[model samples]
Target chain A: MTDAAAPTRPIILEAALDAPPDLVWRALTEPELMARWLGASDIEAKVGRCFTVRPDGPVGEAPIACEVLEAEPGRMLSYRWRATAPGEAAALDTVVTWVLEPTAEGGTRLRLVHDGFPVVLQGAIRGQGAGVSTMSAVRRRQAPDLRRRGDGRAKMSSGEVIKWAA
Target chain B: MDLFDFDEAILEADILRALADPTRRAVFEQLARREMSVSELKAGFSVSQPAISQHLAALRGAGLVAERREGRFAYYRAEPQGLAPLIDWIDRYRAFWPERIDRLKDVLKDIKP
Candidate 1:
């Protein structure tokens, strides 16, 4: 995320990856690959596929239902996120978008954004197992592609080098 | 950015901006343990009631703290919910660890003679 300060708009969480644009794009759009990393649960992403992400605790049964918004090839993908609560309102639905850009060194700069999370669910996002697990799922799926080092290792992969340059 | 900007939902930037201040953070810290009145907050600092009010206004605007008017007293307390997103957002970055380590592994693989 560009930390230059959007000044109260939306808090952007962004990261650059060392994978090719297509690989990065696939990890986001392909259902199987997505499940390997970050699916609220197991899901298939199509223009109009509906899926549920089940939480793992005494919180009863909360299935996170979602509909795919945009799934352009190698460019962008988005979805609608909402809790399938009995009295849930339409206005409460959130949107998540993923944008991929090809960098100079053939790596993809990936941006994963969740735009509709309410001020209330902040609890879910807090290092809670579900939210953290979801984010980890996404990162792990992209790990092979990103392959960039943070703790200073001697050998750097080609993609890692490209990521550093980006 | 908005105090809840990290949340993508709530579009209240003033609240985050208000909390971004050192004085505001201090005020929040004080209010965390218990509810206190406007005058009570003012007593802890050298600034005037007007300044404290100004700070409280921003905090109130951000939803970081909510005020209840009980009779003649306006009591302020921490809105723990307001702070959760920031905590979660920061924690998400920590998820980067596994990926970073995996990247290091790939680098190691490349260097193997």
Candidate 2:
């Protein structure tokens, strides 16, 4: 049986930073500043550049392999992230987009969207089995009524995967 | 390195990959509800018996299912501990961003005029 009303939303987290948009953008793009906040990363602010964020201390030790998709200085930054592991051929890729907007009160509203996780998770897992005919039959049975909602953000509230931080 | 130094994402991905198939997921769900032997499990699905065995083997390799042999039959059941790595991976991100953002604030404050 399929879940009829299941929402396929991406995980989105937002925070209002006390810094200006430029400063917030710099913190996100600059390696030194990013390392102080995110993790030990070799991030470049330019588009199409690949980067790696190594685990720092206890936060994350597994390296995150990312490729820059969009890099607009002082505005938005988006990348595809996947955790590298040994012997896994097909790693699930999720998009992480950071949108920075300057607040009238001199703060930056940072909206972070980690998108494509639900689909990616489903796709990655679905590709593992040898029962293609059975899988496709199930997919065909379930595909008609399923529809993606606006911006794929509304479904995060109902997602059981990642519990948002308090 | 210490015993805890191993990356759990590898195991998490393996388990997710193992259960990704619709048939495998159904099989695993059935096993979760009640342990079943190959013949019993094969009866519910339309796939060949060899295919079911292959799916079970993948599940076993991923540590998501455990098997016990009794006489000529092998019974398989879902392994709950096999899910711990995936749970921990998700939990890590739950704590990761909020804490990092807090630290980012400190970084900004220190560098700001």
**Residue-by-residue lDDT tens digits, candidate 1, A9-61:** 13233455666767766565555554444433655557887776543323343
lDDT of each: 0.53, 0.67
State in Å the error of residue A116, model 2. Answer: 5.6
Query: How closely does chain A match the true chain A in each prediction, as TM-score?
Result: 0.54, 0.65
Q: What does chain B score (TM) in every candidate?
A: 0.74, 0.86
- Report how far off residue A149 is in candidate 1 (Å): 21
When summed lDDT is taken over every stretch of 10 residues in candidate 1 chain A, the lowest stretch is A1-10
lDDT of 2 by residue, A59-130 (tens): 335677889999989999999877756676323346789999999999998888775443212332343443
User: Which candidate number has the best DockQ?
Assistant: 2
Over the full model, what C-alpha lDDT does candidate 2 score relative to the true structure? 0.67
What does DockQ give for each predicted structure?
Answer: 0.07, 0.16
lDDT of 2 by residue, B3-110 (tens): 112456566567767766778877876676568999999999999999999999999998878999989878998764565554444334545555677788899998
- On a 0 to 100 scale, what is the lDDT of residue B96 in model 2? 57
